[model samples]
Target: MQTRTHFTTRLAALVVAVAASALGCSAQADQTTDKIKSALVSRLGIDAGDIKGITKTPMAGLYEVNIGTQLLYSDANGDYVFNGDLIDAKNHRNLTQARMDELNKVDFASLPLANAVKVVKGNGSRKMVVFSDPNCPYCHQLESTLKSIDNVTVYTFLYPVLSPDSTAKAKQIWCSTDRAKAWESWMLDRKAPTAAGTCDTAAIDSNLALGQKMNVNGTPTVILADGTRLPGAVSGDRLEKALSSAH
Candidate 1:
């Protein structure tokens, strides 16, 4: 009986090996991906270009669809779609949100830093980018939080999307000879920016265009060193923790 069991196990292993050899793993995966892509375009009526790629998720039968920066999941057959977070049952972690963050990460060095008002504190070893509106109350709140943070460099891009008043205020701050000081003075002290000189305010315009291109729709959008887009006015401690973790 023992010998028969051993022979059966070896036979099963041999059969699996033969099957794997007949159809390579890479080729099998590619075939599945192609089928999903075809289903996305034909059955789902999603544009072929919009369907970036279909990849298997940690859950065996589920697959992730990369649609630009957003992530959506579908069944193995690509019939049903899931639009919510994929949670790990055992670990109690939001795996979908984590994957989305990874996919949506931007390149920190790719930003046009020259157009932004640079403020350095302490050793300035940590770096962060912020899209802020001068007239935004939340931006003012974020500014207050940023003031408490030490050993960091903040690149403030004047993103005036709130109102027309925001644009005027942004222009004034950007046109100032001492932009960094002017920005802090207004945000921290309630001191309005002085009248702008005839100096070229092209940088402000460039910043506006750049902000639009980056799809920054709101003020106080903070980007940490790891290219994580943290929207809204977060507390100083949270911001500091993120900076530390990235480092």
Candidate 2:
């Protein structure tokens, strides 16, 4: 009888342990969800009524929040917020790149490719987008570096800065016989194109508006095919490394 009682006691304990474990998992899920909502409400200044849903990600404890049409993330406690490219270190892969790509997408098809001069190097299979000022020395250096790269098609936006003289030169380039040739002459040969002063050209106005929309506060900003932006003139090898790594 004593042995029977001991067995029953052990069985009861096992059942309690299993119940506690299940409850612990449920509680943790709730806590993380609660934290995510609370963090966004307090820090992001987003109205609680507008919050759609928050889903926990496969990336350990991180969460993916769907706020209307947008996606963002917060910590378990909703204490931290960031934009990050989740990578697979073991495979040297970009895991969250596709999601990030959707998040920061550009309408490549709709871009006024004609307003920007096109440079075709090699077979021009690879594509890149560059925003550059006519008078920016760093932009000139980037142009010089770009000439050496092969099999790449470049779309150059006329982002004039430095002074009023730069804008005038950009206008002249847009009105020149060959926009590509005009840009190269200014950047490579340090020769400014003569201003026919054509107000009809749309390149300067279009580029300026696009730059503002892209939050580009500086010159020589380069965007990769995967929608990832390099804020400055990146090195040739490093640029290739970044561009090729996109999934």
Cα lDDT tens digits, model 1, 142-238, are 9999878999999998888778878888888888878899999999998999956346778878888987666676888888888998889998888
Looking at model 2, report the run of 10 residues with the lowest lDDT sum: 95-104
Q: Each prediction's Cα RMSD?
A: 6.1, 9.6
TM-score for candidate 2: 0.60
For candidate 2, the per-residue lDDT at 247 reads 23
Candidate 1 off by > 4 Å: 1-52, 197-199, 212-217
lDDT of 1 at 129: 94
On residues 52-112, what C-alpha lDDT tens digit does candidate 2 reach at each position?
6777766776787756434677778888776566667888877566554455566566667
lDDT of 1 at 143: 92
**TM-scores, each model vs. reference:** 0.77, 0.60
Best by TM-score: 1
Which ranges in model 2 have alpha carbons more than 4 Å from their true place?
1-102, 242-247
